[model samples]
Target: MSRHLRLALVQASAQSFEDFAQGLRSLMKSPNAAELVIYPELHLCSLGAETMSEREYYTAYAEPLDGPRGMALAGLARELGIWLIPGTVLERGADGAVHNTAVVYNPQGELVADYRKIFTWRPYEPMCPGRRFVVFDMPGTGRVGLSICYDAWYPEVTRHLAWMGAELVVNLVQTSTSGRAQEIPLNQANAIVNQIWVASVNGAAPTAQGHSLLVDPEGGIRVAAGMEDTTLLGVIDFDRVAATRKFGTSGDSWPWDQFRADDSPLELPLYNGHIDPATWRPAISPETRNDLRPAGPVVFCRPAGENGPQ
Candidate 1:
């Protein structure tokens, strides 16, 4: 059987929670509705940083993982019988720090995975940075990794996710500045270097520049949406990810397969560490791919001396 996933990327504008929910309902009503639907970052938060203070915005929207908003989103996924990634939510962590967290719900309404934004757009973004990388399996379909808006700029984020067996990296974005021009190319580059599918869903007009796109494993733009509220629908074949890694990107480059079993670790002065050649290749394989299913909350790694989330 073909491991194909029918998905939809919703390039939506900033809107109230009620409006967004209604729009999702409308989307499911269509006969061509997708089996998996994803929205842009903070698509449900409707953040108004210009009008209110960061604390006020948090006070207004931040909630725990089991909060009402999260439950409602899960309910929608269960009702629609589709995998749902409603983008990042303002999660009020138990440690008292609010995080820009991306969440995923399976068809059964289970909150399978949630990843905090490790690279929180720096000085501008007030949310605390997440420490770990996250990826979840979609049973027989594929394993997917999660990344937020600023995470794409850091190659380490996508590299680690791909290493952890992610065939597709769903990067939820919401960029309302000139930075989006750079983000588009970064998405393709991430896909090219990692040899994984990239679905970058950005918020539409008023909230963002809205050039949401999907790039194949070979770094080809399969589909892209302009600055408008539209849906980019496509079928992702996980087999292609395996084929790309087996053969070569454009049938010429084999970045992951270049490592040898006896190669020594390469030093890195920046992180004061070294890349272990023993584990250099991606962990995914036909025998171990099914093992990528969620196994509690796993934190891939953190900087030396850095503690886990506070």
Candidate 2:
């Protein structure tokens, strides 16, 4: 059996929710329809700074788990006979808080998982933060991890999912043109450090950077999209993930094992939890490793004897 699984990354525009559905449908028309398709964060809504003041606009877009957009994405998965992650949408929580949630659908058109985004960057976006990360089983692929936009910024989120035995991390993002340069490299770095495959999908340019990228366990870009509305296809070889983890960057047997042996650096009780820190014991003889290095920018001299930004 082939260990390679095909995936489709839909670089959609910030049109209406219905328009996003149509874009996905058009992408799946090809004979190469993948076993899995992913979309960007806030795929169903606009992320322009002006939208923040329009409370009624969000009120109209926010829907329950079984809303119209959800139904459309679920139906598409069933019609295409593929698994789907319909990006992050505005969801109205039972507690009256609005959540930025990523919904997953199985081939059977059933909602398998609904992951609320945990790391919401305040001032950038206004939404309730999710408390935990979610990992689910993908039939052909191994365990899959799901995160949205800002969540990928924090390494702890990916590390937690990696420790939970996730083989793939799918990040749904919505970034501006200026942010893509930084976010793309950050995503690649996370995949390499975790020794797992990563698939990042984002909306098109103007509103988003639209540089959707798929990175292998070794931090190789398998497929990437430009700044436009289009669908990108890529394949992931499960064997590569297994091989990379077994023989990590420096021939180390699973890097996470040796690196994560001590979680003392993460003060759980003090950071988020309400527990008293005085009861906790400090880590003894912690290993110190410096991975930082200085990097110089590439400068291109123009024909006119002028330098350009790297």
Best by TM-score: 1
TM-score of each: 0.91, 0.79
Task: List where candidate 1 sits over 4 angstroms from the true fold.
Answer: 285-310
For model 1, residues 1-310, the per-residue Cα lDDT tens digits are: 5789999999988777788778888988875489889999998887575698887898888999998999899898898898999988999999889999999999999999999999998788888899988888788677888999899999999998888778899999999999999999999999999999999999999778999999999999999988998998989988888778666788798898675667888999999998876667675634233333223222232321122111
Candidate 1 at 93: error in angstroms? Answer: 0.8
RMSD of each: 5.4, 12.9
Query: For model 2, what is the alpha-carbon lDDT of residue 301?
Result: 18
Model 1 clash pairs?
Answer: none
Span of 10 residues, lowest total lDDT, candidate 1? 301-310
